[model samples]
Each structure stands twice: as structure tokens, then as C-alpha cells.
Target: MSNIRGFRIQHDSLTEKQRIFIDDFSKRYTEKTKKSKNYISSNRYHLCDWMNSLGFKLSLKEMLYPIISHSSEGAYFTDIDGNRYIDIAMGYGVCFHGHKPKFVYDAIKERLERGFELGPQTVESGEAAYLIHHLTGVDRVTFCGTGSEAVMFALRIARGFTRKKKIVIFANSFHGTFDGVLGKMAEDITIPVSPGTTEGMVEDLVVLEYGSDAALDYIRKNADGLAAVMAEPVQTRNPSLRPVEFLKEIRKLADEKGFLLIFDETVTGFRVHYGGIQKLFDIKADIVIYGKALGGGMPIAAVCGRDDVMKIVDGGYYSFGDETYPDPYVIFFAGTYYKHPLSIVATLASLKEIKRNGNHLQEYTNNLTSILVEKLNNLFKQKSVPIVVHSFSSFFRFITVDPYPFVSDPIELEILFLLMILKGVYTWERRICYLSTQHTIQDVEDIVKIVDESIDEMRSGGFSFTF
Candidate 1:
């Protein structure tokens, strides 16, 4: 009877029928994914996939192994066990163009064949930078190995440019695992969220609510010492909540207060709109960190911004063998694989395709997702289920209403995902999923069908959904 707001359900809390279902489900899942489970157990000490970090009771442990992906194509992937699924997870948004997009894959393959030359600038870097500038209207672009790395660099640039130490972040927004930004909201200032993150790392962080008048007031009161206000524009976990007005206000404040506005668009970048939240809302940010879909399913991230703010990269722009020289007050920015050829080529290919298709690519996918969300919500309403599906562009999540009489157990919430997996849908952690450009009306119909069947099965198995 405890309505615990926790990430998981305890095995002992299930009803007798629920327990029987779990037992049978776990056995079948383990048998189906035996190789993956064995691989996890064998590499338990060596390999660490945080997606499988949640350790359940031994009896239910079999449900934890990720599907060992053998191959993937547009809108679908085949597991090592030959289970092909409509991959709504879409590599957690990295495959916005869908798995193994030919344009990106071919570019990467060509780059690999050409062999990456070390200590030299990549040939495609300029083209990639141009595409980014053309799309986002940013003046400068810098690359890194991952989103976390790009976040760190963005913070460093903000501090260097403004000569200020503090930053403002929002609660319920994830800005990668970078130590400086991994802070939880506190009474006044932010505190480190993870154990290894020292208190001093987040000493200058001010964490507050994402979209609130109180948070805006706090920022206004303390704008002088703040270097930047970093936000996810639209949070990855809770796609339903869109604070366009709040973000526009923040943008205005950033312009007036003389502090940078950093949009951490690691997950939202091209998935929502080709130009990300900036174009979607017609609000420009001082600096934007991009990853996920920007990489074209490759490992890459970028920090881009206004020329003046981004000038901190080399202190100030200088010409070759001219009066202007590299400024001494520059922040050190370097990475061995900063502009790796393969990544650059992939980015170039993806951006070009996006440009060729214009905004239609995103518009089509976003429209499809909206239709899918409406269908699922209609089903929930018709069945009187205390559940609703919310979406922002291609991203969507299921939310269960609290203290609802139709839902007597929290185990039912977890079972929805298990049933989804068994029914050939690729669900990821936190019930977050993304649609790809390859997902068609047919795919949406299939997803709706699977969801309806899962709900009906749960109802028949004594899971309450009636007032």
C-alpha cells in the first residue's frame, strides 16, 4: 500500500498473481537472453554498463540484461537472439536518423578506409562547422569526444569569458556526468550528486527549479556573480514539461545581465528540431552544447556560441603572420580526438542530409510521434487506466497518476515495461523513448497495437484499471 516514489518495485510487494507472472516472465526472459545474461555475469568485474547497474533480487535478476544488439537498420534492430524490434529507444536519441543511416554510415566507412591522420586537422571539420553555423546561427564551433566533455568545456569557456565563478543549473535537468554540473538542488547553493564528486567541485553551482517565478527571481537577485545559466531547454526525462516562456525569459535575462545562457542540448539537439530549441522557440542562447543526434550515430559533441563568448577558446581571433596574435588570456582547450576524421565525416554527412531535406525530416517525425501519443492516450482513457503518455517532438514517456483508485499496485507500472519488451518493443531506462526519421505510420500502428495488447493482458491478469 506504500506509494513509494522510487525507480523500481520490490519483488515481495507484488500480489500472488503478479508474483507468478514475474516468475514466469523472468524465466522466459532469461532463457531468451541467456547469452547476454551470461556475458554480463562473466564480465561483472571487468565491464560496467550503467544501464544494467540496477541489481534486483536474484530471482528477478534475469530481467536485467540488455539485448546484445547484433545489427540495426532504419526503425529496427535485431538482437543476438534474433529478436527484431521496432527500436523506439533509437540508441537513446543518437540514431535520430535511425540505425545505420546510409549517409552517415557510408561517410564513416570512407573515412575509415582513408585512415585518420594524427596531429592534423580533419578535412571535413570546416564543412561540419559551416553546417552547424548555418543551422544554429552560432558564430564558432568546438568539438570534443563526448557530451560530458563538451559540457566541461562550455563551463570553462563561460567562466573564462565572464571572469565569474558561479553557474545556475536547474533541478530535474541532467547536464551529462561532468563533475562541475552534476549537482543536486540544495537550500541555497547546489551540492555534488555523486560520491566521487567533491563538495568543492560544485561550490559555485546554484541549482533551482526549471520553470518557476521564484527561480527567476533568485537569478535576478544573484546575476552579478553568475557566469552562466545552463539548462536542458527541454529535459530528457520529462518531455511533457516544456517551459518555452521560461527559457525565453532566461534568454532575455542573459542578454541584460551579461551572463551566458548555455543550452545543454545533448539529447534534444536535432531530435526535436534541426536547429534544436533555439529555432523551435525562436530564442537564441549565448552558448549551446550539442551531442546525441548531432553525432550521426558516431561519438562526437560540440560547444558553439557567439563569437565574443567563444573567443575565450583562443582568447581572441588572430590572423596568420599578421599584427593580431594568439591572446595570452586564453583557456586551454585540447583533446587528442577533438576532431576525429570519422566523427567529422559522419557529422558532415548527417548535417548535409538534414539540410537537403530541410525541416521536413523533423516535422514528419514529430507529427508521427504526436499522432502516436494521442492514440495511446485515447486507449488509456477508453480503458479508464490511470496512465497517460506525454511527448515533446519525438521523445515520449508514460506517467501514472498518483493515488488513483484504478491502480492499486506500483508493480503494475514496472510490468508495463516488461510486457513491452516481451512484445517486441525496445524500451529503455526510465521509460524514455525516441522516434526516428525512419519511423512511419505503420510503425506507429504497430507500437499502438503492442501497447493495447499489453494493457489488456495486464487487465486480464488481475491488474486493476477500473474505478
Candidate 2:
């Protein structure tokens, strides 16, 4: 067996027999996965080889090889090895309408036939903007090609509108891959998650604990220099950690302190409701960033805000011909594919479908997720495992307990991930699972069964709580 130290398996407290059992189980699991993925094993090996040759260093846990996808429709996708799995990751929550919904696909197809690349504007662009405005009650909307770009623009808008240098963000609240917002917690300070962040990248950032008094106190003292208080309405990885009162307090402070309240709803927007958690909680934001399910799998994102704030990007008003405009400052927000015709069509189709069935879709998915969480918790209780299942809207997580705190170790999480994938269920590395409108109650029940069996197998293999 491979050294447990390399995998970071912290089972030094386990008995000799238990350690042997775990090692033996790991070997068996390796053999089983290899046998099951024999057909695509070579493909994965070659792909990994190529990646290595190109100087890509991927950890074992990050590698999702031997399970290449072929095609997908609705709630399930077939692998290259002819294996079908219920897709819980759903392209990291982009396939809320499921893989290739007929309406969205047809819209894309129609746009392609007419002409995908025209110029800056398309018929669907105006229509999509209108739909978004009608749904979220935002005065103006602008499109972008990716969530990261949309967020970057939102921050820029906030900075321009408020004319403040500092911005505040909470721990573990991912806005995007943007360098300014990619910081992680280190002791009490926030440091860049990626290495390329310059020395002063976080100089203007006020990183705070979510829902903490320290955050509120800092905002109180430094509100004058803060441009925005940006947050994810529901943190994608840790969804159940919603700070309802904290959000309301932030909104109140933003109103009184002259800072913009920006909600990064990339994952929560269309998945939770037509207007996202803002609608659900009746808390309004000055600017909202949306992506993920916005285009039903197409690459599209929107930055929507009040007319006064959004007008900063009005190049027409800032034209040199307008002599009356004294301060003709223009906040440039542009991309060649800013309003891609295909993306617009897909967004329109997705919005229409969501509007028509949103109530039932949200209710059914939430209920199913609740049920799955209950079943998994019951299994954990039966096994006396120090783990609990929790859900927020349509998302679920498996949280560890005792010595490990609320988070699972990377190795443990990867083992659970592999087990779920082997049992025909797909989830992300964070142990986060999403339920789509396409998933039926039966599908959720099947997921519960697989989870139970996987846990049982792990327990039998000497997996035990350290405390």
C-alpha cells in the first residue's frame, strides 16, 4: 500500500488492525476503479502524461481522469466508458435548467443559423436586458462573457460611483478569480489565494469575518473610505452559513455610510429564485452580479444596478460633442463578445423557462435536498460517525465534526468524492452538491442510497472519527 503520509491520512491514533484495514481497502479501491474504468484508463493516462509534459502539476485529488464525459441530457450524463451518472456538480451550478434544455438549445441554434457574430447589439440583447430588469427590478443591465469579468466590472462601478479606495469582503465568499477578491484567511489577515497577487493587492481591501462584530466595527470606522461591501448571498461551498441579520445590517450601513452594497449572486441568482436571495430575503443591493445559470450553460454574465450607478458607463452622455457635460468621465466596460448573440438568445430562453416554472422548481428541489440531507444524517447517526449533512436551498454539504472542526480533510473529501463518482453521482471537491430542476425525487433518493452505501463501505474499511 502507498504511504498514508503521502495522502495526508491522519490516522496515527488508529489501532494497527484498523490501519491495515484502511491500507487494504485503499488498495482494493484502486483496483476496483481501474477495472471499472479500463476502457478509458488509457485515455486518462495519456491525457495525464500530456499534461505532465506541458509542466502541469495536478494533485491526485484534483485529477478527475478515467471518467471522461461523452454527452449529457437532463439530470444525467453518460461517461465515455458508457457509464451514466447523476450530475450533482452540474458544471458548478451552471446547468440549473439541466444539460441542453430544448428551449435553450433551440435558441442557440436559431441564433447560430441567423448569425452569431454581428456587432455590438443583437435583437436578443435588448430583450434579455428587459427580462432581467423585469425580474430583478434593477434599472439598468449590462452583459459580459464571464462571471469573473462581470464581478470585476461591478467592483469598478462601485469604486467609480462611491469614489472610495477601500472595499470589504467576507471570508470564504468567492466573487470570482479576480486578483483583488481572491484572498483567503491567514490567521486574522486575508492573503492572496494565488501566488501572482502583488504585494499591495490587498492594501485597499478590508477582509472581515462573515457576520462578525469585528466586521461591523471596521465598517463603522472606515465606511468613508469603503467603496462597497461585496458578498455572495449564499457562499457556494458553505451555503448553510447564511448571515441573514448580518446582511440586513450591511444593507442598513451601506445606505447610511454612502458605500454601495454589491451582491455576487453568480451561483445563487437563478438557482434560488428569479431575483435570487435578494428576493427571498427582501434585501436589496445597489449592484447585483449574476452568471452561472444566467445563460443556461452558455458563457454570459450581467451587472445590474440602479440607473444612477449604471450610467457611469454611458459613453453616449460623455461624448465630446456634448458641450454641456462638464465632467464627461466614462467608466469603460467593454469586450468584443460583450453581448454575444448566442449568449443573449440562450439567456432569454433560460429566463423564460425559469419564469414559467420557477416556483415549482425551487420548491421541489429544496424539498428533495432537505430529504436527502435527512437521510444522510440518519445514516451517519446510525454509524455513529461525526458527520452531518446540511442544505441551503438546493445545495447540500457533508460537514465533519469533532477533532477536524466543521471541515473535512482533503484526503477524506477526495475519498468521498471518488466513492460518489464510482457509485454514479458527481459532486465538487468541496463536497458541495447541487440539485437541478431536472432532478426528480427518485433521483435524490438514489443519491441518498449511494451515499449511505458509500459511507458503509468506508466504515467497514476502518474509517472512524478521531475524536
Pick the lDDT winner: 1
Worst 10-residue stretch by lDDT in candidate 1? 1-10
lDDT of each: 0.83, 0.77
Tell how far residue 183 is off in model 2, in angstroms. Answer: 2.4
- lDDT digits (tens) for residues 144-235 of candidate 1: 99999999999999999999998998888888789998787767557777777889999999888889999899889989888999998888
Q: What lDDT score is found at residue 161 in candidate 1? A: 94
- Counting clashing residue pairs in each candidate, in order, gives 0, 0
Q: Any idea how many clashes model 1 has? A: 0
TM-score of each: 0.94, 0.87
The alpha-carbon deviation from the true structure for residue 162 of candidate 1, after best TM-score superposition, in angstroms, is 0.7
Best by TM-score: 1
lDDT of 1 at 284: 91
Cα shift from native, residue 128, model 1 (Å): 0.3
Per-residue CA lDDT of candidate 2, range 317-392, in tens? 2455565563456687778888888888999999888788756777777787788788888877877766777778
Clashing residue pairs, candidate 2?
Answer: none
